[model samples]
Target: RKPGFTLGAGILPFTHADYIGEVRESGLSYLSAIKNATQYRQISDDITLNAYAAYIFGLIDLAFPDGRPVGFWFNQIKQALYLIDSGLDPQIIANVIEVQMLKEYGVEPNWRGCVIDGRADLPLDFSESYGGLLCQNHWDKDPHRLHASPRAIFYLRRFSTLDLNKVERINVKLDTKAELRRILDVIYTDMVGVTPKAKRFLDQMHQWQDRLPDDSE
Candidate 1:
């Protein structure tokens, strides 16, 4: 359904080569020389999609005013893979990545006050509709505000400038993590407008993963 230059240079940049081999049966392996690279074997669909998340992000970066940096894009890809390799949930990793990028590339949400008015003393509510966060008074005025946990907000602030090493150090409660995950899903869906294929895939994977007796993905 597409034409030449389909998925051009960096577009849909494949995170793994096996996916290509499996899809096209070309008998060519990117890792042919290093036949024993265990890191590339037995990857999960959720993980692959998580890695592909970077490509989606890269596409978004195309609109960056400064013209996206190649190193920045590569670093984001590495961050996603690193979190996955560290045994972190691909979903959470994606959220953290988005939170960080939302600040760096996207609008740094006014976590300090209301998007409509600068009321810096009240609690915050994340509003995807207007972007960034909301205040208690504003939250009262609008019913569509996404849930925002203080801890989640706290960690998101840190994620804006913190490396994965520092990110790993934050002691987040499980419930707070879950809340952050949901909040980010809403934020990303609204930010992108119409859920992205990568996100839809992640949601589908979550449905199945949550069904297991010991589900923990």
Candidate 2:
């Protein structure tokens, strides 16, 4: 009944090939080559949205900010593929790549989530362990305020019990605050964080505690 809308919708699948072919045929153009090389299927919905956003927001040009023409966008694509080739989860690798692309291109992603209960997957034990490690390393004197540092300690603890050698290997690879944060965020959001209602109740308790006056006899 709705032939016009239906026709366009039906043609949507064909547009994939058209886009791929356009970039592939224009091999001489760096932008086109990057686009072609970065084209990926079988990505998760979230990753697909992120990649589409990057492409639309002039990621190719953004990668060359300061007029340096460094081809960092291509480099990110290469790195992501390398990780995938090395058996990393495609969605995780895609998220990492998207984050790197945003940073390189000077785009700040608007992160949204509940402050306390948002990350239930983050194991409390792991957070404590990571927090201890952070303290030992002098990364931060106070782990309570440093979100992921404590979580890194937790990772170290769990990995230590499972495979100490692999723990060391992974630790070596994780050299940045951003990487640490990402790992903790995933764990917290998926497994360790609490529910929103629990978080709210906790917050209310804290507020009640704050209102109480100190009594030193």
Candidate 3:
């Protein structure tokens, strides 16, 4: 919904093209392409938004191979971008998207219930190695299970099923956010085995935000 030229990339026909070491801007301008794509209506070039966009793109790279689409996640990705643009809590949005990506990649944690007993009522901890939540009865399954608090598990389950379009804003405690971050880190490292460079950049940006002086002061 903004007017101005912005940086973007799109799938284009390159079948009959040859002269290429690195395609230049002149070539891009010469190609006939559609303008004012509806998908980009809500997107803007602000740095914070761009950071989240990059992170989302990085996740997409990890989730799918080049030149392919995963139909299941198409709308989920749209929802994430919209939520990112809507100024919701970005950490929570990232966490939600990561969980969805895990589901798409077939390693999603057992947020619905304990992996062993299927008891959804009991207190649970996250098991990175065992690949799901473990109640006290089955904690022995993974010697290094993550001790997730009830609050953390609650939000994890909620975020896993969250409808981003319905949320305007959210308030997450710093401790809860930290727990979510740590848990996702272990899950991604253990199961996915790759970290996107954009995630590292986003982490540094978050650290910078944390170190900044309070504006209220």
The top-ranked prediction according to lDDT is 3
**Residue-by-residue lDDT tens digits, candidate 3, 1-217:** 2344232333221111222234354555333443433443334556666677768778888778865767867677777777766677767888888887787677877788888889888788888876788888888888888888989988888888887778878899988998899888888888878788878887788789889998889
- Give per-residue CA lDDT, model 1, range 171-216, as digits (tens): 4676877788787666655674334455565566667866768654
**In candidate 2, which residue ranges exceed 4 Å CA deviation?**
1-39, 44-63, 71-73, 81-88, 94-134, 137-144, 149-217
Error of 2 at 37 (Å): 7.4
- Candidate 2 per-residue C-alpha lDDT over 1-217 given as tens digits, one digit per residue, 9 for 90 to 100: 3554423422332122222213233356222211222233332234433333333233334345454655645445544444443444433343344334443534332222122333433433223333222323332434443344444444433432242112112223434434553553454344333222222333355457657896862
**Better TM-score candidate (2, 3):** 3
> Highest TM-score: which candidate?
3
Candidate 1 TM-score versus the reference: 0.59
What TM-score does model 2 achieve against the real structure?
Answer: 0.29
Better of 1 and 3 by lDDT: 3
Name the 10 consecutive residues with the lowest summed lDDT in model 3. 11-20
Worst lDDT 10-window in candidate 2? 12-21
Q: Give the TM-score comparing model 3 with the true structure, all chains together.
A: 0.77
Residue 178 of model 3: what lDDT?
88
Q: Could you estimate the TM-score for every candidate?
A: 0.59, 0.29, 0.77
